[model samples]
Target: MGNIQVALMTVLMFFLLVSLHEWGHYYFARRAGILVREFAIGFGPKLFSIKRGETRYTLRLLPIGGFVRMAGEDPEVVEVQPGQTLAVRVKDNAVTRIYLDRLDERSGVMRGEVKALDLERDLFIQLDVDGEIERYAVHPQALIIARGRDTQIAPIDRQFGHKPVGKRALAIFAGPVMNFLLAFVLFGLALLLQGVPSETSSKVFISGVVPDSIAEQAGVEKDDLVKSINGVVIGGNYEKFVEIINSSAGKQISLVVERKGEDVALKMTPDATTGKIGIYPAGEYRKPSAGETLTYAATSMKDWTGRIFEGFRKLIFGEFKLDDLGGPVKTTQVTVEIAKQGLAQLTSWAAVLSLYLGIFNLLPIPALDGSRLLFLGIEAVRGRPIDPNRESMVHLVGFAMLMLLMIVVTYNDIIGLVRN
Candidate 1:
């Protein structure tokens, strides 16, 4: 593909990831009877939108992120004022004669060819709009309805705040959970498309090495056998070998390798934080069964999740440093580079990206879903909500700090790209 086409596809894939994340929140919120005012797939100015029922679906200018606006964020303050003329259009054709005064709490108006009328509080009413019964939900509080505007706030009955703590937590947790699912799907697709590991992967050998990685610098060549690490003999268990390498990050280690029947002793230092030798273990290719694909996806998710927890554990013990962290610019650069490879490689990259996003959102930092979950957890334990103003202030401060960090990371990413 041309450079322009590559860039477009990259952006589209990124947008897809963001859309899936927001859709998870929107789906759960609606399931719990919460009011979803808007379901938007992007940030910034409105590009195009369509209204259906209570929710307005919008596409925005910025393609990096998206949001699902729930009712509790801006609850409707309803007050009835007498003689307030509210324009209620019962039909599409304005000249056809239908006024707000015709609406009342009495025996409801059964117009010519009446469609559907929600009798309770007369909140939801549907009338024929040019051969179609257009449904409208009117909040009991608001009365003024301008053209193409929803005058009704979400009904008090279905407000998010009124829901039980468990339901609220479910709604909040759904976003990150969906991200994991997205990753699983991507991995599963890659497995099905590119085939699975061959039986030969069981043998200890290097298939590839990352440029400038410890293994490459240590003269670890492709197809070279790894007989031992440090002083311990090599094990048949793949997971154990990976754990040993990762945990030994920032430490000097002696490696004994068999190169064409000759044993070679090599000294290497793993990356300080990642413990990455930048080497991919040898894996042969074979056609995958349905069960194998599913298993691969599940295993990928488990492995990625475990790695995240391991990183956190190391960080807590001061074994990890902040310089290892990456930002969106770095991620975008990775995406562009990955796209240059085949679809299978691209899918693998996306799976890792989704996994990282899901894990990151669960951190107890402010202005994140995890922070909201932490607040909900506290409310569950205390049997009451936290002070709204104080919570809001905390999130505001967190957001500012995050923005500043993003600036620094972006600058670093630019410098790195230029250096490359």
Candidate 2:
């Protein structure tokens, strides 16, 4: 029962964060005077939706993805021939050559095509478009891909391309920027609630001792606070003491610890193995003043962003395994565990998630904010935008590849869960 609650909390928080990310784009797009058609909260089929002021807010079946559909973002032409269809009147019971328009699946435009009308059966004509024959339905809602010449149906003021380059770029970039902003706010709020730490502790203590390790063999026990090593007092420099321990690999050393208010001396030879320490310091956690909170947040944001970049570098370099990456399943599990830990941890986790999402969205991958910005950049340099059809195709291919990667990651997550 507790697990279920935790999971629900996690999923809710996750969805909220993602929705905010999309909201960023929608906000900027509208602010730029571009019309946003839909602000969907998820992908795939929409389960429910509300329409207001020309924008539809949708809740979809998939929880892991969302999008902001801007007006004229893709090459589109909508034509209607709304009415009941009847067999074309045949002349002398012979096939008639006629032109008809219907929706093209690719371009979403009703295109003109010359086809041989049987007028007896099928009653439809086919037109060759881009080397493929497109059959037009003679009924209502029959749309076709636009053939030849550009036929933009949307008003220039409402089209995304009609916006200035900077505005277009800003709208595209807004999603990731919002993610970063959310992380900062969440971090600051959590810090504010927790209060700032005005004190620091550097006391060195063994929190745990690995079995059969040199420290354990030497009779070292957990909760033993170290006062010095080899006559060298830490002097509140806990890290220096660790450095001394690591540097003395394969050498005999005298360890001095405070055991229950008594100084205990023990001798042991350092292990020759790499990463030899079986001992770990009990970490410190503290808060800072209000002024310090801002500084802390900024510094923490920078540091965490750097860590994300490094993590990606490592993953690319084969230092990280595909299984090491988490998908929605892993995120759900982590979220539940963090929620159970308390609000402070959950807030911090959300902040981290926001940072991750922000950085990832800014990556130069197709179907992402970064890629959209790239297309805009090309338009800026070339003094004209690339063909919308080509651009849309590239993004489509990229989306498919991204979906494949997601499926692979999700599969791996499921396997890991089952094994565990």
Q: What is the C-alpha RMSD of each candidate to the true structure, in Å?
A: 10.4, 11.8
Each model's backbone clash number: 1, 13
Q: Please, what is the TM-score per model?
A: 0.64, 0.64
- Candidate 2 matches the true fold with a TM-score of 0.64
- What ranges in model 1 sit over 4 Å off? 1-5, 75-151, 197-284, 313-324
Error of 1 at 256 (Å): 31
lDDT of 2: 0.73
lDDT of 1 at 271: 89
Candidate 1 lDDT tens digits, 268-375 = 888898898888874446789989899999999999889888988997898966656666778887788777655677788888878887888889999888998999
- Residue pairs whose backbone atoms clash in candidate 1: 198-284
Tell me the TM-score of model 1. 0.64
